[model samples]
Target: MKRGVEEIVPGTPPKSEEEVIEARASFRKQYRFPPENNNLTAAQTRKVRLIYEIDITLSEQIDALSQLAKLNLAIRNILPPETWESVASIPDLSSQQVSLKVLDSLYAVRNNLSRSGELARRETRRTDRNLDLATRSYERAEKQRMDFEDRTGAEDSNSSIVTDRETAALASQAAEEKLALRRLQSRLAQAELALVDNKIERFQPFLADHRLRVIFSPEHVQEQIGAFSAKEADLEKSLLASQEQFDQLTPNAPVSTGLVAAEVTPGETVRQLAQSYGRDAAHARVSLNQSWINHLNIQRQFYGHRVDFYQNKIKRRQMSEITRELDLEIQRLESETDYLRNRMAQARQDAVRIGDQFAGTTGISPQLIQSLQDAAQEIVETLRMEALSTESTLSRLRNFNDELLNRTSGYTWHEIQAILGDRLPLAWNYQLFILNDRAFRVSTLFWVVFLVVIGFFFARYISRTAGSLLTSKAHLAPGVSAAYEKLVLYLLVVVICILIFNLFNFSLTSLTVVSGVLALAVGFGSQEVLKNFISGIILLIERPVHKGDLIEMDGRILKVESIGLRSTQVLDFDNSQKIVPNSLLLENVITNWTLSDNILRSTIPVGVAYGSPTRKTAEVLLEATRSTEGVLASPEPFALFSDFGDSALGFTIYFWTNTADRLKISSEARHRIAEALATENIAISFPQHDVHLDSLNPIRVELSRQS
Candidate 1:
């Protein structure tokens, strides 16, 4: 069947009566769209299905959970002051558990209020519709009554017929609807209040504890540790130096019988008795120094150990939690301190043995030798005591940790979860997807970009396949082959970009509005990128610069290796890769040596001593160019008398060669030219200055190099 307007042939008017009849008869339907049924009935309102789809499929539930996880992370990151980051003090598990139970009640109340709010909304809608129907019924009845009275005379019409009982019923119905709406709205208001108040009440205790901890917590235990460590280091260094000096003293050497320590047996002038003792006097002096150093070591060890005690206190700051990690750390410290104690005992035994040897050989007083040995023994003893005390402290800390863990472990799992703060429980932290919280909600755009990247690499594979086919089956220069592949890839990119832009610009919105904003953004945000793209397009089309062309820009010569969409990679003389923006080559004055053709003219300036024949030198230089490789034979090499320098006549040798690395080829030709010149007895020269001296003014001389 033909639909009327759709089947009507374009530009075909009904030229006859029969055609008009046929057209009229064939008026058939082309489309039937869905019907609008927006009005909800009372039954539907009463049975309001939950808007949140709790009975979703497993996959959909997982998706919802994933979104909730993202929301949780965003809340954690953006609301740190409200979370554990701002928590100053941790409350006991029991206290925290009590607060959490209260919070659970509050959540239950909130959920109930939420359900009631939905019910009240439905009731309001039902009552509103009832009121509308009643108003319409009243108007219709009034109209009928009025028309009935107009037929008869108004004076003869009965009050019961015109002003019927329906009027009072309509008024009562409207009043009832108004009262029901008010009651529902009032209940909703109270629910909202009760929900908010319960939330504040539940969280008040945690916030109060956090605030107190933040205010009163120790801030810089690290600084105090540093100060105590400095004193400890000074005392340790002094003790080590004393031990070294004591060990270095020679045993069995002469005691000093001089003014040193003033113990020379009341000598006739204290220095004269020391001369008599000879080596004995020197040994006596060393013994006195060793004894004094040992006395200082004992004092140093006592104070240093005290500093160590204070440092241990500093290290123990803010670790009140009984975590598995703390237990491991305490055990590690215990083993290390035990090892330190054994090392200290070994050092003390060596010191005691040396002290006894000095007392026996040098015949020093037993008391003085005993002092040295006692100081060493005392330091080792102090270290051992400190080690024992640390071990005891560690044991106590472990007991404390065990007790706390047991207390927390006695609670229900959910209660323990409360003490761990508000991270999502392990059950819900599924790594279904990685999150970039900065653009949390716009993850779809990120997916699009990620997919586009995969597509971009796929596009490259296609380009490379096409390129490889060309290289294997067809003969093309490397440069042309590369250009072909890049051209195909760039075309794909341009098409894809346009398609993506149009998809956004024209779908679900006005094309003109989106295009205007897009144009403005591109113009302002990526104008340079756009310029480079356009410049690259021009270079590709114009062929003024092609891959493998040797060109110079900004006084540096580089060979074009690859032409990208926005930039070109070039290899310089040193074979170093340099990336130049497409716009840079297009906009600047670049010299393209291999642009027009690969045949290029190269010049090498030459100079011979002032007396050398310019023409002969030219012949020699030109002849040398003939033997050099890569030089064009058709356009034969030529030389010219170019300049007259201070002491040399300069000549220029010119040659045409197929383009190559400019420096390499030019260097070869120049070497040949110099050899040709040397063989001809024409010398390449340096500039020389002549001086004339006047006897009276004697060439004013500086002692530096003179010509």
Candidate 2:
């Protein structure tokens, strides 16, 4: 099955033995590889396929290595040193080395152009493929239309045929437009590539000459100043042209062409146009303002660079001539920035004029004014983002320049900072809100924060003062005073919140959504809590049980300690604090001893021996009750002989006292009654019992001792 190399490979036949040997050697060089075999076994086919796969992989590896080499060369030609800090010792040499930094930027631009070109090429191929497919589809549609035209059909069928023909024609038109768009894109890519090439061709020569002058002859650097000045002049001219364009430009209102005046009312049409006009004008105005700010910052940076460059030249004569043109370049930047500032102001005025056009016009709708305000708000938000970005860029630039100045100059850090405008006021005047053309700025944020902090203390003070008045002057119950204080505090807090919302131009109506969410939450899970809160409010208002009032609930005696919104605090008989839900008090049957008054009636019972002196026992009981502390003398103590028992005559006494001290009064009364009964020889009795045994159990009484 083995074939000669000349048979397997497509090449001239080897005429001599040496040539055959060379061919065989080359074939075997690919290690187990076989050339194309049209008629071969399965094993030879596998070997050929494997050889093809290896060829593709090797080709890709070679391409990757070539790209890597190109990148390495670029780095070597344009990259700065790995250690920038160490370069400060040899400033001239370092500047001369990094003088090609401009070339790096140029190379980046070229790389972008190349990537764009590659994409354009891919788009071209894809569009060409699509065009081919579309052409085939159009041909198919046309053939269908012609066949339908040749057929004899009903009237309805003829209409369908006409429709089919129109569809075919439309498809053809679309294909033509697609091809045209592709051609235009290809031309655009070519033009961009040419522009990049031209810039490189023009700038690279100048860079090379400047580098040579810095390296070989530093004295002839003054001659190159004229060339740099000419370049600056060119840049100035370009800046002027751009400013002119910016000034002349007006953003067209984005009104839809489909909005027909006949379809809508005259007012509606005007409203739509007004909305678009206001938005467009506002966008233009914000854009101009942002550009002006950016230009101002750039001018400041140029001024710093210029001063640094001049200071370096004054301090050291050995500065590299390559960077000498940087001073003129910075001057040019400053001049261009000034020009931008003037033109941006003009553009801003024009935008204002457009935005205010409806102000003096008759029959202006309120909706139009509202739309203008809304557009201004949108631009305010956009400006906020732009301002933050500009602020970050300025800070980074300042830091970088400050560090560079520190490393390369004899100036102190503070001096460098001052030179970089570190002492300039911050952007606190930047508008954060635009309400009907009125601005609320970053300074307003400070006011809001101040108000919030001070409002907290102020609310507390007012609540405390109100609480004192309710407790002292009004003689209100403690729980009621606390409730009123809380209400006052919350009212103050709400007022402060409203003021804060007003500062941001937020309507309280917006809280309806928040209220809805809260209502949903309450309906789902807080029914019992809400019930308790309402019950607490009822308790405070109706004064059902005041603080220090004794009450018995669910067989336990408790004193009301404090009433709150959700629950009430009480002290049990054991003096332990307990939290009871307000709903429990309202729902459960509770006995309030001091609901009407604190006076409570308590009863004491006594038994005297065997009817010897029942009247005396009653007298003794009455005397003890009258002598007891906290017993109300106005509701005088009363005693009576009630029931006759087997051992003694039972007597009862009743007394009135403060409900809170009832238990203590009863205890003290019992002690006094016992002492008085003993003094009167009226013996208090105990239970007596008599037993009878009918059997002979009492006859024999014996005692036995166990061993």
Candidate 3:
């Protein structure tokens, strides 16, 4: 080897100066190696080598630790911190092995921040837009407020004007009232003056009569005296005529000569001749005289003796005179009586005539004269009042006519009269007469046409309306339609019969009264039946119940099968039909199932064994309810463990169904529950009895011994 410029030292090798420089350069180079080189000694590097090794190892650990820290941070970001410990303890490579993990996390964070920022910006923009819209709305509202204020001001002004108009109207009314009051006062004063004038005029006749009271006299006594003297002269003339007739009759009677001869013989006494004459005469005369005297005596005795005769004659004469006077008095009395009787008869006739006259004139009795007089007086007063009123009206009319004439000054009264005269005849004979004739013809035609038209319309209306009503499903219940139709036909026929009778001018009023009385009798006799009849009519009119309805009455639910006039038939839930009186139905309270639209609710209760998990049982029941056919789903089924029982839990499962056949649905639900219970091995308990025999052998022995 070539000896280099080396200085040998004790226990040390020496190198040339160039070698040292190179070694130094190499050391420097090694020390100055790039960060990627990692060329360091394991030792003899001032522990820098160990330190470097350690640092290298530590760098890996540090990287791993840093990655774990980052992973912890990432986990903290992804999940809650409390979850980190549990997750970190899991056997897996730390985050250091995971390349790009931090980068991904950073990117995720950045993206999230960016999205959040964008959302914030959009929200800010939306807020600004809303603020702008609110500002515009406020402006519009302000404009509306201003417009409302203007309208309010105008309304106030209009109101003020209206108030002023009302005030002016009130003032005008007050002024008119004052003027009317003045006019009334003036009219009262004028009426008072007129009344005074009328009273003064009425008293004028009385005053004139009083002035002429002393100028009256009487003159009638001379006529009475002359009439009495004429009566006395006629009486004297009749008496003289009676005396002259009596003298003439007395001169014509026969003479008596024996009385004179007897007077001459009594003075002379010629003895013998006188004696002989006397004897002869006496004998002859005595014989004749005796017979005559006897006859006369007998006659006188038959009549009475001479003195007694004279007395009797005097008595008879006196009696005749008395009788004649009595006759005269009786005749006078009879004449007076006759006169009185004739006067009474005349008076009675006059009274009868007066009654007849009263009857003929006023068709009433004379006893009602006071009432008649009062009526006449009232009529007279009324007439006087009417006359006064007519005069007033005439005055008013005259004033009105004068005012009209003065105002117009065009037509003269003669011109008016001429115009009236010219129009009167034409109006009376031509226009009015022709119109009357035409009206009579029109009225006849109208009555004829109206009767015909109304009859036809009434017939048709009755037929159609009754037919429609009887045929309607609602009116004619299920089984009674035929009967109702017959009833309707009968009613129509009866109505037609009545109408025909009316057409013939029969007195339907009397007939109707009789019919009403008959109806009353029938109604009283059959109140329940008549009530049913009336109730049927009310049912038809009011339509409270109809066919095919479900109703509950008298604690029985049934379907309406037939509604007859007398009775309503119903098919009960048991499928048996029953007939009920219409009156009874109407009079009693009833529940109509279909009245509130055919909706019904049905409830079913169930129980499950206790200690079988109440929640689980409820869930099962709800499931069963939901699965049941015909159960409503939108409302959902619910189950409730209502109570705990001794051996089971009481539960209620509620569901809804719209099936028309409720019985079938209920049966099916029960079957389904039974099947489900069987499949789930669930026990269903029943009321039961258990018996025990403590000593079967003793009982058997005792039975054997008894046998």
Candidate 4:
């Protein structure tokens, strides 16, 4: 309550001039650096742990040297001089220059580690200074916050003394505002009643004096009616123009309402917001209409009575003045009514727009909608809490005001002091209110929903772009590209989800509960999808087959088209695409002809007629293979005489091709070999049968008897 220049800021501890200087001197005490302290710091702890290990290593080397010494002494007599000299070199090996140098280095390191704990302490001085700065800044901010609370009753007050003062000030202010607002209302009421014509008992005396009375002349009455009609017409025109401009308040109104609760202008007090309510003209007009509608009716009756009195009493003196006042009052009331209607319409329209925004139909995001909803709920709860808190505060304030107003009362100032010491009752429910809740402020749910939406598109774009780049520029195999692309996409998704979970303010214990529930619900249904997903990752990493690589699995020769997250697409020899689940690929044995390299080693088996020269047949087969297109010449095609068949000699040609599609190359090679064999007069043999008929003449005589 008392404001003045003191030794310290408000809400800070008071200190004398001498005490302040002493405090400064204490802070400035010169640091006498301690003598070389050997106490080990934290960083050396790891090195110190190796102490026993280093001792064991040294002990092992010592034992090895001792054994060598015994061996040298025992063999010295039997050995040749050169051999004895070699034995003497054992000591030299132990004392070699390189060995001494390494030992000296280790010794130096040990000494340094032992003596340099002081240096470690010196290195931490900067950290201590930084901590000191942080502490001082924290104290300063705390003092500032306390000062703010003392002056404004903003921060939660603990000390009864500070709480009492702040509560007393707030109570007094709320009372003062309520009183002024009420007084203003009373004065406005009197002004409206006076402005009305019906409450004219005081004016009846003047009218009762026959001399002051005005006569009702027919010509003047007719002119008054015409003038009043013209005024009404002008006022109607003004009201229409005012209604058109009434929407000016619409833009600023929504902005103020839409702001998040914590973002109010700094240093705002409860009193300031209360004062603004009366400043709104539309609100004031609406209040006046609702509170004094009866007065308005009375005013209407007064206007009628005065006009009737003028007509009856034949009054002539001040008839025009009374009529003019009635005309102005009627016009003002009509304009206010029209303006209020227009303002209400604008308010309704703005409400609808805000509602649409909240419902996510106005292109405003749901997070923004949630933020707006939270802000509004916080405001409502805050207002409700304040209302509950003010009931007791207001009651105490009114009692105090009444006590102050008493003259020669038994309630002395000592008793008043005693009464002020007692604090108002607590608003117990305010503590339970959600206005200051951290859950609303954390915006966890909003960000989770938002990140998930963004992560999906981001993962998709990266996967697609990676696949295209690897296939076109990097020239990776189709399956490899597909594998890598999908791999990166899935990894990105997992990383984002993990980061989102880690960033959540709420404990993941709750998330675990939710996830457990979901897992239980989805366990059976999602098993296949889960299996395929894991298998796809395996397929990508292991790369049993790449896209465009010919693979034979389960007796089907299929070429891999692409690898996906759940399924791998392949093309049959008939050029039809087949989607095979990734699980199938991992479960079955797949023969990837070109997984490692593109060159496929093709083997073709051919047969030649029996009794044909084996050397000639082998030479013919080799020449045919060499003539085949798409076959590598550097490997030197070789023909293996595999077996001697019943009717022919079988030979197999082995060769390699650079062509990726081995099927095409194999077919072309077959065509080339056929032409080459025919040109060389080495006919390809087929299974044949020859019958010997040396004893068949007796069977023909038996067949003629049956005829």
Measured by TM-score, how close is model 1 to the native structure?
0.36
Ranking by lDDT: 2, 1, 4, 3
Tens-place lDDT per residue, model 3, 419-467, is 6888765553442122212432444444545765666666656655665
List where candidate 3 sits over 4 angstroms from the true fold: 1-501, 504-507, 573-575, 633-638, 642-647, 657-659, 688-706
Model 4 per-residue lDDT tens digits across residues 251-366: 23322334335655412312222223212433333333332333334333443444464344313233445445545544554555455456555545544555553453444455
Provide the TM-score for each candidate, comma-separated: 0.36, 0.36, 0.29, 0.35
Report how far off residue 307 is in candidate 3 (Å). 99
Candidate 2: how many backbone clashes?
A: 0
Clashes of 3: 0
Global lDDT scores for all candidate models: 0.54, 0.59, 0.46, 0.53
Strongest candidate by lDDT: 2
Residue runs of model 4 more than 4 Å from their true location after superposition: 1-451, 463-478, 498-507, 693-697, 702-707
- Cα displacement (angstroms), candidate 2, residue 432, comes to 13
Poorly placed runs, candidate 2 (over 4 Å): 1-460, 470-487, 490-500, 573-575, 642-648, 659-661, 694-707
Better of 2 and 3 by TM-score: 2
